[model samples]
Target: MSVLDQKQTHKYSMKPESAPVFKNLSSDLPSGLVVFLVALPLCLGISLASGAPLLAGIIAGVVGGLVVSVLSGSQLSVSGPAAGLTVIVLNGIAKVETFQAFQLAVVLAGILQLVLGFLKAGIIGHYFPSGVIKGMLAAIGLTLILKQIPHFLGADKDFFGEMEFFQFDGRNTFSEMAYAFQHIEKGALIIGVLSLLLIMGWDNPRLKRFAFFKFVPSALIAVLVALGLNYFFKLNLPALTVGQEHLVQLPQMDTWQKLVNQLSLPDWRALQNPDVYILAVTIAIIASLETLLSVEAVDRIDPLKRVTPTNRELKAQGVGNFISGMLGGLPMTAVIVRSSANINAGGKTKASAFTHGVLLLFSVLFLSPFLNQIPLSALAAILLVVGFKLTKPSLYLNQFKLGWEQFIPFFVTVVAILFTDLLVGISIGLAIGVFFILKANYKTPYFFHTEKHKQGEVIRLQLSENVTFLNKASILLTLHHLPDNTEVIVDGSKSTFIDYDVLDAIQSFKVNAKERNIRVHLQDIPEVISTNAH
Candidate 1:
């Protein structure tokens, strides 16, 4: 089928009844397994960055996968605790003191999300300009590039937690790169380079066709290879070493009973702190925005071209977040990485997401020791690829072609995100984008399509639909430029709605007609208004 045909087929074929039950279930199970692998380290890493208990991340992943998958309206979208929210959560934890208090704020945030979903606030996502969304993706991509450099170079002193343009360490992403060259760890760099090469080689067309490697994920292969190299070559290269400090160090649980004992509850005392309220509100807004953005991104990539119910997504996410918080977990949202992995793994339903959660639970319970052995640098390599994908040069080129209106906002958003934090950068970019749109509309002629009549040189100027105060300047300019001794006919036939200010402007133009030796005429106007002359 042609691309257009495929798109239409995908779009029209998306009915719940039409979904292949058995086939989807089978495909999703394995797909979920893949997503589980991708999500595991990320969940732990993000949780650590957020200053929350490592178990909290696993709990959020499980809840997000299991609970949110069942409740969400999206078929292939995956939900989990996001690195995007780590900074916010970290700050929230610092302000709220005890982790229990932070849990209360998370619960409140969940409640707020639930309310937003019920109120159909997800519609807000629909209104975001396509340009701005593209820009956001680009900015996120740039951030990934900047932040991953230190990891690639084995520089851990500058914490991975920082996403701002300028760091507290008095360096930006670029400056860090400059510093990294001089103080590069040979072991980490070699391993990172080898991991990257292996990943790139796995994607080579000829190699991908090989039966043995075809089904294996490049990330898994890279990790295994790195581990083998670490063991065999005994490369004591400092840069190559996946530092113990950088790895996922799960809290030592002596037994299954001890693990269960680590579970926590929200502190009611946190509710008393005003900072908790602030943090809750911030979480609600940022989480909502991130979810909305991810939904959009996922939809773009979906082969089925299915449109997800945004409100239902919000409600599902709320429930997930609430449950996660109650169980001592970080905040959760529908993330693009695992979602894309699900699709790439041929996931066709929510079962994939649920299965991923199940797999995560199993890994945590049974494979904790093995998981801990996987180097942090190896996982960092995975994220490094993710980051590169987000900020690729192709994305920048694509945004530029979308026109200046889109490009400017997108560039600004990227720059803002690079310099500031995610929320602040997105806000600034969104504000600027909205302003440009309004300004563009303001410059458009309020009245269009003029025709001159021979009898009295009567010029009929037709007003377009939805005229507002912003069009006043255009209208006035047109009127003021009209030659003297001309008969002016104001036509409102096409105008469905006109603001009072526009009507006032028209009335003023009529009053001033005699002074310019112009005769005014009105056509297709409402009888009630036409009869009551100003």
Candidate 2:
């Protein structure tokens, strides 16, 4: 199918009115399992990237699924240690001497988010331009694909979730790809190729209709198949065998005492250090932006067309992050990948989200042994697909067709992220977007569309709905350059608030009209007493 057709299909699936069985446990259970399967690899990979303890990602996943889901107003969106914040987390960790101190930062960030939620800062999410948001989404998608390539090839030194141009090693993104080719392990390459092929086949339209396939996530099936192959055939084809180094590794803890010993402790002393507060504010703002964006995307795919309460979602995320940090988890956000999987899997309600969390908790507590055997190559393959879905060509084409006003910022963001980090790229995109906003405003404070009348030329100046001091230059420029003996009508009928600067300019021009032979008429405009009147 064409991209347009695929988009239409998604839109059709999301019309919430069509699906009335939101409480169907049968559907939600299976769907939640699928989301859990997807979240596992992502959580681990992101934690790896953040330089946090391996268990920290799992902690974020559990809290996201269990704590945040319950508190969130979003019935469908899922939360976890997102790739978008991986770089920020790593940088924050660097700023503080220990991971424990970073956890303290996460706690502070959560508190900030709570304050923002109460302040109703969620409305600000709506103010972000659509072009910038799409740019961000696309940039993240491309970053995922680029960062996962080395992992897929079993070059596991670099973090699978790193979005920056530079790697943990000194190499940049393309340089890492070159190194991966030179150091490719035969066994890993075979597994990666096969697993990727499996993903492609699983995406086939004809095969998904089977009842069994309908219940099982394609990613889970592919991972299981890869694991079975590695476990059974590792001895025979050494070249194709996935080593323990290339498989999932979880710390073995048989009892509650052992697990408690493994958990890291946050340094309360770090709270008194003012530097921690700076990191806290940064994490809170960036994490909130990422979460709000994911919520926006997930709401689009929601079967019920339900609108998520952004403020409530922020509060829920705040609570979750605070708890996660207390327990030594990395920062968290509403991640679009797992959320999309949940929606696509026919997840019915928040139960699917809650269930996914329970499943993560269960896996860490009881099933880590089995999970540790899954090859990293398999997860990398799955992420490759997830990445492709986000930066699809169709999304680019759609934006390009919208004109340069949208496409320029979108393309710039993608390029910026490719060369820099997520936060930096997004900042560049926002800066460019703001420039466009100002550019439009520079021309729009007042209407300058002139018309010819029987008596020479007539100029009608209609002030915009909200004219601020920014409009002063344009208004004055028009007034100062008016032709002699021209009739000018200044209309403020549609404006609710006109700045004093603008009113003063108009009143000054009215007084100067006597010398210039200009005829001036004001409509619903307030007069400013000008010194020129004296």
Candidate 3:
């Protein structure tokens, strides 16, 4: 092996994963800050998209970070309100008639997830094809880039966290861009461009050589810089002043008594309605799938290469969602965007995730006024950077070079997700993948070989070790094509098991062969006699 390769392998093998979670406070602190900055806007925006109270999203974030992180087996995964669940949450609320009623569904969903975890249903996530998973990641990245463009351009018509192709405002993905171009705000535009540049520069290896810049969280720096710029422009550069609409809109809670009034209770009466149960099942399935997928993705990026227990993660999510629901929060799941930000900022343990949640809670309680000053454009710029990294040209090329069998499903997944919702897109990719698998197995289910004998041609049909119903059609076709008056020996000595349908077909063919004057001999293959004659 090359020296560099050996060195890298050694370094990776030496990672101290057994250390206490709080051991790396320096790394966790900065990482928690980055995650907090990324998560704050997403929590608010997802609530806006779901037609739920804005505070509900924040409660989910707090529960996800504080509660889920504590119970979860994953060290690096961060959880919160997910863009993938936005449509479902909206439709569920509409069906249940009230936001409080939807909370009941969320609570039931948590119970369902807990049951699933105990049943060990998390193994389903591991079965996802590698190509499809990569496709999912790429799709999310591209979607983020496309959705964030309007925010980056200072167009505040559509809110943040709209990752789907179709928006709530009657416009599709492309139309949002067209709208942004026409109504772009100059001040927001300037800050977006500069923030993008700074974020990109921070990631560059050449610029990161400076030790001073290495310790600072790039996304946090970007937000603070953008906030300062907007404030400065309003005082001095009048033409470049950004309007309040283009900035974040955290709810203003000025006093402690007001915070208590904001707390909401779930409608237990909704559970008596049957529709709530259906919604509960739907939420449980989708949330578990998203969590498993995120767990898989986060493991792929971990520096220490620690494996997470999927069942434990589901249990953790179940607990968090239950608490959040009881407290009037939206459904929660392990979100990819904030998790990626946490990893990129050098998070070492679950402490970073939990700390980020604490920061989120503290920020809303005490720093809402300051957070409101942060521009949406700056946050968009940070998301754009993450989006670009995920959908890099290298990722596309790698998938393409894996051949059409892999590429077709992978490419199909990306296109479907762009046009449809997350679950629908993933289902399409899985269907195409299964088609390829069945096609390969349909043709070669038996070993057929012929040799010339002294009297006549001797044919041997050797059944595979575990031939089943899938091989029935191929065996029937081969037997029918055989020349009349030929000597044939059907062998199944090596087979551990054979389907009854295949055995019956061979036995029926033997009777037909006798009339044609063909010599048919059966070896260890089973014979079936019909009992339906009674």
Candidate 4:
């Protein structure tokens, strides 16, 4: 069939059935432990950075893990407090007059997300081009690498999970890295470097043969070893001890009563306040966006290539935010960092995410002291590996080989995200991707052919099945540049729809053809009053 005659066909693939949560216990358990280890400090760090109580982050993490995981159809995506919303949460608290008021906003945001889910607003995510999605993934990978370098060097100037180019500390990503390099703590650096090396080496096939390496995740092992080394440093190498400042700092809530006392409730009276409603709308929009983007990215990296129902994901996040706010927690989203960690750690089912949540609650209640002993450097090291996996050198070479149509956007996205933030970078990349789409459409909407006849040459122009305003310019150019003393046939027999502007151009051209001794013949094409007549 000719290109224009070909009908579009979609190949439907059946989604793989998800293994039962407990069926994959061997792999899921260890994967959950790794995610828990990575999430602990982050929950604390993001909460501290957001100007909220430390318990707020923990509460959100728990809700994301326990509640969202159960309600969500996505087997692999892990949700938690997102760093992207820190600035919003910080400013929101100030505007609302109290943290309690902000909690009210968060609760309302969840209601809005639930509404959006029911309205099927999640379909908006499907409109993003594949090039832009790949660009986003690559950009996130690069950001992780650059941002984690300081933590790897033992300079904890920036909070964990901060992804923006410009930081709250008055230093940009690069400047902060420079500052960290200049003031490296020997003790933290020792733990950081060694921890990174250990995790990297722990993945060898030779090591996997042993049950020790098979059942235990490298991230947990690295943390335990770092803790032991830090202790040894405190005793033998006093100067090299990893200090308290560089360790995981969970709020000391030793008793159930103390934990309950720290839990702050949202002020229902704040619902009547205009500012509270405004913040709620803002949180709902931004949180839903981040969640959509993160889940889309997660699906791309999933080994099974399972497609999560986007509408269902929105509902799950809505429920998570509502419960978290009710319990005085920070706003949450499907965090790429934690979700990617879970996938890389071999988590096979939703059980892994649930296990991580259980671990978070357990650690908060009974293991706070031991959890605190784990070094930030160790977590940083694990993230570094995750970062490297995301932005591997092979990925760049592959994109480059796909031609400029793909490479330009991918390259631009990586650069834009590195210098700006996630949402902004993705927007820029989307614009570029759309430009290419339009460019391609401009050239491909019709087929043009030339034939030699006994009396004279003939020009045949065949319109595609559908033509829109975007194809107007191309049609106009072809008609205006026709050669004199030629027989031209403009055919639209197969065209299902044609734009008015295009029809007008064709009608106008027919009227003017006689002036150049050009004979115009139209077949199954509509005739309308020429725009030039008036």
Candidate 5:
């Protein structure tokens, strides 16, 4: 069947069904495996960054994959714990004073998300201007570049902290670069460079054409190589080796079992804490925004050009987040990293996403030791690539082509994100975007008329659709251009709505018409207003 036919069929079909056979299972499975590899490290890293238990991230990923896949309308999009939420999670943990308490807040956040979905707030995502969305993506790209540099350099102290243009470490990304230079770990630096090279080699056409290497993802290869070098060569690499300090070290089994056993209900005692409510609201908003943005982005890249049901997606995410939170997991959303990987891997249906969750669950249960062997630097190298893809030089060129309206917001968002946190940076960019939109609307011509008119000539001034106070200046300008004793007809039959300010402007113009020896006529105005006016 044709693509359109398939889409129509999918849209109209009521019950859930399996994906077609002959779909490339090999590609999807391998892609899922690669994503799993990439996601495992990110889950641990983001969880650590968020001050949450490492397992929480893993649990979020599994739930996102398993539960969300079945519930979501998106076919190829992958859901999981996101690095984007690290700042919010960190702040929430600090406020609650206990992980369990923070988790309670997460559950409440999920409930809020469900309410948002019920309210059909997902449609809000559709209203964001194309320019603004592009700007947001570009800004996120720039953030990746700034945030990943420290990790790439084996400087783990900052751990994805926002770096501003003027500061580094506590200052900005540039300052962090300076700090890294002063205290560079030679061992870490060497491994980082080597890992970068190995990752870069993965895309080489010659390597890709080789059958043996085709099945192995570059990230997996890089990690294996790093592990081998670390173990056999006795390389005294400082940050090169994934040390117990840097690696995800699960709590001791006894302690872990104790914590799990002691899982307490949401402290009803703290229900009155305004901070908890604030956090719950924040999580819902941020998670929803992120999910909507990811859905849009993934659809853009989807080979099938499938459009997901936004409301359904929100509901699915809400359900997943609620369940994940109840199970002591971090906040979950449709993350771009795994979604992109799924697309690249040729996922044809939601099954691939669901399968990925299953894999994650099994891996955690059975392959914890094997996972620990994967070098942190190797994963960092993968993120380095992901970060580069986000902030590519081509992105800048594309935005530049879109002109200043788009370029300004995109550049501002990037710079702001580099200096401040993601949410703050995006808020500033959005505010600026709104300003530009209003300014553009204000510049639109209010009145269209000829340059000159003979005395007593009948001239018609055409107003565009939806006349408002913003058009007053142009209307006045046109009227002032008319010759003395001209007969003017104000035409607004096409306009569906007229602002009170515009009506007042017209009334004022009418009162002054006799002074200029002009005779004015109105067209297509409501009879009630036209008859009442002199």
Candidate 6:
């Protein structure tokens, strides 16, 4: 490697340590600030999209960061209100007929997830094709870029956390961008452009040499600068001033009583409702799947390549959801966008996630008005940077070189996710991946070779370690196409178990072999007797 490459590698790589939570304070603190800035808007926006109380999203973020982080096996993953769950949450609330009922469902879902963890269902996560996982990351990056552009341009019509193609505003993803162009806020645009430039510049290697620049996260700086600029625009350039609609809209809790009032407890009475139980089952299954997928994706991107105990992560998520539901919060999973921001901003430990949660709690209590002053445009700019890094062109090239078996699924996943929703897209990708896997294995159940004999050449077919119904077609085809006057031996000596269907095929082949002047002999193969007797 070149000297510069070595330096760059050394700069980003850090040995995983079992130090105290606060030991990496310098890295974690700045990273926490960035994550807080990114997560704050998302938490509020996901709640808005879910048709839940705005405070519910914040509660999830706090529980995800504080509670989930503490119990999770992953060091870098940050959890919060995931966009993937918004549609479910929205429909769930409607089905249950009350937000309190939905909260009860969420509590029940948490219990289900805990059961799933104990049952070790998280093992399913390891089976995801690498192509599918990479596709998920790239698709999310593209989604972030596409979703954030309107926000960056000061169009606040769409909820900031929405990641679907079809949106709540009756507009698709691309159509919203078109709408954004017609109604750009000059102040937000300026702040966004400048913040984007500043954030990009801060990533420069030269900037790392300066203590102040290295220590402070650029995302936080971008937000504060955007706030100042908007204020300046209000005082001096009134035409360029950003409106309240384009700014962070954190719900105000001016006093302790107001804060307490926002906290809604789950209604135990909802337990009597059958729909609540159905919704609980739905939430548990979907939430656990999303969490498993997110952690797997996060592990793929970790600089350290650290593996998370998926079962432990599910348990952690279960506990987090329980607490969140009891406290009137939305259900959460390990969110990719926020976790990406945490990693990109130099987070070293789970402390950064915990810090972000603490910051969320403290901000809601004391800095609501202050946070409200920050423009959405600035946050969008930061996310844009994150999105670009994730879907870099090199990622596509690398995947392509791995061959069609890998690239097809990866490409399909990206497109599917863009046109549909997260879970649906992933499911489609997984199906495609499985198709390829099965196709490759269809004709590989046996080894075939030929040897010269006194009367003719003999064909020997050696069955694999285990032969099942999946290998039946290939075995039958080989037997049927055997050259006339050739002697063939079907060997199952190595097979520990052969499916009954395959054994029947071989028996049927033997009966017809003499008609084609072929001799067939079975070795260590069980014979299948015809059920019909004359």
Model 2, stretches more than 4 Å misplaced? 1-28, 91-96, 300-305, 341-348, 444-450, 453-458, 464-481, 499-501, 504-515, 526-534
Worst 10 residues of 2 by lDDT: 525-534
Candidate 3 accuracy as lDDT: 0.83
What tens digits encode model 1's per-residue C-alpha lDDT throughout 39-91? 88777767766888888888899998889988887778899988778888888
Please give the clash total of every predicted structure, in order: 10, 3, 0, 0, 7, 0
Per-residue lDDT for 9-36 in model 3, tens only?
3433324434666578778888888888
What is candidate 6's lDDT per residue for 195-276, written digit by digit as tens? 9999999888999999999899999888888989999998999999888888889998878788889999899998899999
Clashes of 2: 3
lDDT of 2 by residue, 301-331 (tens): 5777776777777888999989999999999
Q: Which stretches of candidate 6 lie above 4 Å from their native place?
A: 1-22, 255-257, 443-455, 466-477, 492-534
Alpha carbon lDDT at 531, candidate 3: 21
- The top-ranked prediction according to lDDT is 6
lDDT per residue (tens digit) for residues 1-534 in model 5: 445335634782436444442365656666677677767766766777788877788789989988998888788889998877887898898998877777778888888888887787877766666655665555665655565566666665644323235332355666666676776554455656777798788767798788656666676677777667656434554344544443433332233455465344456556777888888888989999989988877777688887877777888898998888888899989987678666654467777787788878777656677666554555666666766666678988988998998888878877776667656776787888877876665555634444456677799877777876667766766677778888988887877776766666776787798898898888986566544443
Question: Which lDDT values do the candidates have, in the order given?
Answer: 0.76, 0.79, 0.83, 0.85, 0.71, 0.87
lDDT of 1: 0.76
C-alpha RMSD for every candidate:
4.8, 5.8, 5.7, 4.7, 4.6, 6.0
Cα RMSD for candidate 6?
6.0
Q: Give candidate 5's error at residue 490 in angstroms.
A: 2.9
Would you estimate the TM-scores of all the predictions?
0.85, 0.86, 0.87, 0.89, 0.83, 0.90
Ranking by TM-score: 6, 4, 3, 2, 1, 5
